[model samples]
Target: MSRTNIDIDDELVTMAMRLYNLRTKREAVNYALRQLVGDPMTLEEALAMKGVGWEGDLDAIKGGGPIEDLDDIDLDLLPQDLGDLDARDDR
Candidate 1:
């Protein structure tokens, strides 16, 4: 790791530490840097999902039904085990 002396706002660092749940200033700074330069998916990739695994009815949902409508939904229809989607290589 390369070390360099630089000035940074103490309040901002403290906020970052709390927000990111990081312990040290170094960890906070590194986490911030990684977030700043992280590889985000393109719009095309996001649009490609096309509600592949969604069990809900998109048309009925589009009507913006009352919150009480949620009660009618079968709890069993929902995913039982949502294994780490973040760690999926297909993404």
Candidate 2:
């Protein structure tokens, strides 16, 4: 592999390390780069993933069942605050 020095965002690297649970900066960067542009699995490997003991009903989860009308929803039951995000002054 060719080694090169390049500038990268520290915050992004930290986030990637935490998200992927990688032990090193090299591992984190490699994982992130693979995710962005690499498909390490072959077609046979990808096709093999089907019916590999996954018990969940994929069709039901993909909206194959009957859909409910929005009017049927109770607005009062919804959570008031989505998250405690800081208000942006840029707005």
Candidate 3:
């Protein structure tokens, strides 16, 4: 992985560490980046989900979203669920 070093404000770093219970700055940064990698979004796309209930959306809670436009996540394919998957092809 390419390491791009950048300066972050101390206050911001402190807050991220506290919010995530992170022991090192690298851990906090990595956690946040990993959460963000699956769904890269402009700020505008996230605000659209402000009013939705959180009964079933972990991705939205972690990354914020409009939900409707998230095409990468397949909720129907949860591990315990077979849904329409072929019973013969053991996944």
Best by lDDT: 1
After the best TM-score superposition of candidate 2, give how far the Cα of residue 11 lies from its true spot, in angstroms: 0.8
How many pairs in model 3 have backbone atoms within 3 A of each other, for residues 3 or more apart or on separate chains, i.e. clashes?
0
- Give per-candidate clash totals: 0, 0, 0
Off by over 4 Å in 3: 39-91
For TM-score, candidate 2 versus 3, the one ahead is: 2
Q: How well does candidate 1 score on lDDT at residue 58?
A: 58
lDDT of 2: 0.66
Candidate 2 at residue 47, lDDT? 78
Model 3 lDDT per residue over 11-59, tens place: 8678888865678888778767866687475465367546763455566
Whole-model alpha-carbon lDDT for candidate 1: 0.72
lDDT of 2 by residue, 1-91 (tens): 8897889878878987786567888988877777669758657546756765555455544455454776654455554564545643423
> lDDT of model 1 at residue 78?
54
Worst 10 residues of 1 by lDDT: 58-67
Q: Give lDDT: candidate 1, residue 91.
A: 35
Top candidate, metric TM-score:
2
Off by over 4 Å in 2: 40-91
